[model samples]
Target: MPLLRMFRVFVCCVLALTAMGVCGQNSLANQTIKWDDYTYKFLSTGQSAQVFDSAGKVVGTILSMNGDLQMIPLPGTDEEKLKKSFADWKAFYARSHSAGGSSSAGATATPAASSSNGGPAVPCPSTYGVSYFDGTAWKTMMLAVQMPKEKSVSLSQGFKDMGKNPLNPRAGETMIYRYKDPAAPLTTGPNPSFCVSISANFNPSQIMIGTVDIKKDHREIEQAVSSRDSWLPPKRVQQVDIKRVSETVVVVTPKTPLPPGQYVLGGPPMVGIYDFGVRASQ
Candidate 1:
């Protein structure tokens, strides 16, 4: 009888151990694992997973098989890096503008004062020329003063007549033009009129103008420029208004100017596009 009791006790111990082992395996199967700079949320054991950044943005996707983790990084996953790039550009523009030096046309400024009374002066040449309606006046915002090379050829004599002929044609680069009124309050509803002039001729159907999510990275901008896909999943746009101003100029006027954020204006494959920003005045 003592031997029989001993056998029964041993059997009970084995069952308890088996139950514990099963529980432990279940717990591990449901566990989220952290690897390198990403946290992996397991959708299936040894199958599929999602990787996320600290901000909970899906930075990558993971496939686990045979105890191996294969990670695929999503384009524009580096949000912080993109933000820093924007900040650096803004700082450089600020420094150059304050110093009254020639800089990229990405920065926005009011017309320089020609007189003490702040009367209108000759519009500055901007890489991407822009015109906007400021509720009361149709003001031209000139970020630079040099006419583009293509435009210069046609206006050489006209420029000479003004006595301030452009010495050299300014080779234009891809740029973003911004317009903001310091006195205007932050607005969510469409109110301000904003327009941009592109230097290329493109089909109106192929042209897309949309607001960009500053949180996204440069890859998102590239995608938007390519026009292959809408950047940031759902395209952020208030409304798109594009018109053919001339054979060489395609004007884009957003129904309402983006409040204060990054935006993109481009054609399919992003042949010629501008990525610009709007900052609210302090």
Candidate 2:
């Protein structure tokens, strides 16, 4: 009789464990994850939070969390639940991005960002840097600096030179640069394969690239502004076209084919810009 009682107790314990496996008693919000000396918890529902505009104003929404992802665990874990959560976030990210939702996060509080300002905001290797694909590899382009003027202006071979940056070029004597060679050290074929990457955290929208202002002997990039001042030169700023090729990275190209000349990528006086020359392929 005692042996029979022992066997029954064992069977009951197994049944209880099986029941727990089928039921999700633990969820991300209720669980605590301890790794090393740090304690972490699931803080987001894996949905879009708040979106921001150029000036950082609230916008719209994306996907909503449908179920708990276990947040992480195995042994009869809710694998289906986890998959659904990921799918929801992925679809939501696409819709939110198209709507210009800058603060959208797919799985947690991580932001898939974008820029509305008139400059390259992210994912250019550096904050204010650019690169070009040489059919072999992507190479870093150098930043071009004008002699340091104050206001925006235009200069050409002899075309009525528009206003020029009036600020002091530097603490040293104001000077003009003359170049026997192309101002940009790197040169690309007229139809270069350069692109902008819009991976998560890389905002490719607020970017600005322009045709380098060619003078008698020097090149300047002062006309890549949104102002489009009648006093400034025309066709200096080139609009960018964005196309997403994957989950995190989008390729950006000049909407128009570049003509043979110098081009600048980047903006905002304080941040500076990257430059390269485009020439006929030999």
Candidate 3:
């Protein structure tokens, strides 16, 4: 009878342990949500945080209270698709705000400014200190800087150029560049042009612009970006025309038009590499 009782107790303990293990696994799975190539972990505060791929690594704080999660695209994400996503989110946000419903956690129900082109005017996050080129002049917008605790060395040269400006007296700590109209039609030219405002301290000779060889596999690209040792190699190092618009502003244009692929604009020692894409004109 004693032996039987002991065996029964052991069985109960085993069952309890098994149940606990399943519960723990469920909890872990519930805590993480994988969206595309990125895995986002829910914080204790219920906020979903995403880090930007730039020099001053900005964190996008998303409120997930109402189960409606709106987010900015991760760096190296297809820019063309992101524009559509942004538009959809903006519309949803606007409707929610109009209905007096909470659109995002901690976000007030304020209507976003309407754009001249009949699209929702999405304000850029001020945390990254960004400006945009409006065809004629560079206009500053959403100038806020939130520096990360651990300084990242992987910010692209283009990001660095946009963030660290000396001329703008009212500029924030870190600078970023945004498109005036994200949904603007892609430039259908022989070569697409990218412009950057160079700081006085930056050495023009160290700036290197080349096409990046992105892997066909999304997992491979994510792994390459995450690993410090996995610096993706650049192909066809061509000389680009570095036209100086001002003492502080310079435009780097490739001599030949880039084929439809991913590219990087930065220099050797490979610390501040930036990523851009060339999509087929639609």
Candidate 4:
């Protein structure tokens, strides 16, 4: 047989095998894992402590953040990664402190606000980018962070329910994202809006989006996280009135500063235009 033909045949077989493994897999609450431009890190204990993105992809690992502090391997990822995540956050806080460690400058600010307001240049400290909906279109701006080598193992095991590990807290910890409002409603008159949703590789665990309503808009546009057990976010809706500049252009400013660390935007989902929609106004 021709060598070229044999190579083609081998490639076909590999593709076929991969498709079979994915096609019949159990549905974990109708969630799909997207592995595009996304990679995870494993911590010292052979678990994943964090996931970073090179492209504008929503690659999230099971982790949390308090202020600028990233909650590394809850109890078990990298004994060092957890300590490092905390250490990095502490150092960041120390630098931003005017007198105390509290930053009055704000952590995550929207480009629109930063450009117009003469404030310190807001950096992309979070893992993911900002997502927006303009009724007719969706827009997202994302930034990916690099994972430390020591935490690679923990980052991997964190997404799986592999019995009990010495590092992670439970089978899977709560995965968090910076959820933005879907510009248009799912239905025209009265229905669930096309809100951004999230999922993880492991079972039982879920993504949560928490929102807070800063403006007295009858619609409570707050930052929130979504999980099977509950949906949460550290802050409430700070702003509303997401501007749909064009069909695919949606711009919003978060009402409050975003928590430090990595995050992702879920969607610029399909929806209609109207003043009733919501946006994450930082």
What order do candidates take by lDDT, descending? 2, 1, 3, 4
TM-score of each: 0.27, 0.43, 0.29, 0.18
> Which stretches in model 1 have alpha-carbon errors above 4 Å?
1-201, 215-234
Candidate 1 TM-score over all chains jointly: 0.27
Give the per-residue lDDT of model 4 (tens digit) for 190-261.
Answer: 111122222222211122223323223222222211222223333422232222211122233333344422
Candidate 4 Cα lDDT to native: 0.31
Highest-scoring model, TM-score? 2
Candidate 1 lDDT trough over 10 residues, lowest sum:
144-153
Please give, for residues 67-130, the per-residue lDDT of candidate 3 as tens digits.
3445655556655444443444445444644445653422223223222223224332222222
How much lDDT does each candidate structure score? 0.42, 0.44, 0.40, 0.31
How well is each residue in 55-168 modelled by candidate 1, as lDDT tens digits? Answer: 677876655445433556678777554333333333433454455653322223323212122222333223355544444444555331111222112233334434543443
Count backbone clashes in candidate 4. Answer: 58
| Candidate 3 deviant stretches above 4 angstroms | 1-190, 216-235, 268-271
The runs of at least 3 residues in candidate 2 whose Cα sits more than 4 Å from the true structure, single-residue gaps closed, are: 1-44, 47-128, 148-183, 191-206, 221-234, 242-252
Minimal lDDT window, size 10, model 4: 107-116
lDDT of 2 by residue, 8-59 (tens): 9999999897665333223223333221111233335322233222334332
Q: In model 4, where do residues sit more than 4 Å from their true spots?
A: 1-241, 256-264, 268-282
